[model samples]
Target: MPATSSTTEFSRTGNGSSSASTKDIEVQLQQLREDISALAKTVAAVGNEKATEVKGKAKRAAADATDASYQMVEAAKSQAVSLERDLERQIRANPIQSVAIAAGAGFLFALLSRR
Candidate 1:
């Protein structure tokens, strides 16, 4: 008896399924790079917007401080004017008393000069 080896036909076509092609991997890598670039752009834009907002707020705060300073100055001027007017009114209403007070001061000065 002679032993013989036999070959079996598995398929007629050579087409087979694979995980992914090289071109598909390249496409996926390109998409990931694009997504990263887009995310970086978004973060930069948000940072710039926040900086602008802070700058505006600082400007407004400076303006408010300036306004408050002006208001305080105006109030001080008004108080000084009121004081001047009151002194003038007092002098006018008590002319005789004012003269008597001046005479007494003068007499005191003369006595001090003698000393």
Candidate 2:
């Protein structure tokens, strides 16, 4: 009878320890979930910060490209004006030869158009 009572007590103590262990495991699992959630938020914030920086860089690059394109267009216009002035000076210096060359070009165009 004494042994039976001792065995019963041991089983009761084991049940208590088992319940306590289960609670401890549950608490640990909850803590891990919270830690993971916090880490996810941190990652998202870093990603957003990086995205903003990239957007700023892209805007700056676009502005630079636009400025370069404008500069090229202005240079082309300046070159075209310079060439027109040179052509006018040449025509004025050799009016007779210019007219003869114009007549020859016109004859060639007429022959080509007939074909």
Candidate 3:
């Protein structure tokens, strides 16, 4: 009878230890979930910050490109006007020579077309 009682006591102690271990595991799992949730939030915040930075950079780059394009167009217009003035001066200085050159070019073109 004594031995049976001791065996029963041992069994009860084992059951208690098992229950305690299971409860500890549950608590650890819950803590892990909380930690993971915090980490996810941090990651999302960082991503948002980077996205905003990238958007600003893109906007600035686009503005710079637009300004550069406008400058190029203005420069081209200025060059064209300067060239036109130079051409007009040449034509005024030598109208006869220009007419002769055009006639010669037309004759050459006619000859080439015949060939």
Q: In candidate 1, which residue ranges exceed 4 Å CA deviation?
A: 1-29, 91-115
Off by over 4 Å in 2: 109-115
Clashes of each: 0, 0, 0
Of models 1 and 2, which has the larger TM-score? 2
Candidate 2, pairs of clashing residues:
none
Clashes of 1: 0
Higher-lDDT candidate of 1 and 2: 2
- What does candidate 2 score on TM? 0.83
- Candidate 1 residue lDDT tens string, 1-115: 1222221121212122223455677899999999999999999999999999999999999999999999999999999999999978988999999789889999999999999
Stretches off by above 4 angstroms in model 3 are: 104-115
TM-score of candidate 3 versus the correct structure, residues matched by position:
0.83
What TM-score does model 1 achieve against the real structure?
Answer: 0.51
TM-scores of the models, in the given order? Answer: 0.51, 0.83, 0.83
| Per-residue lDDT of model 2, residues 21-75, tens digit only | 9999999999999999999999999999999999999999999999999999999
- Whole-model Cα lDDT per candidate? 0.84, 0.99, 0.98
lDDT-best of 1 and 3: 3
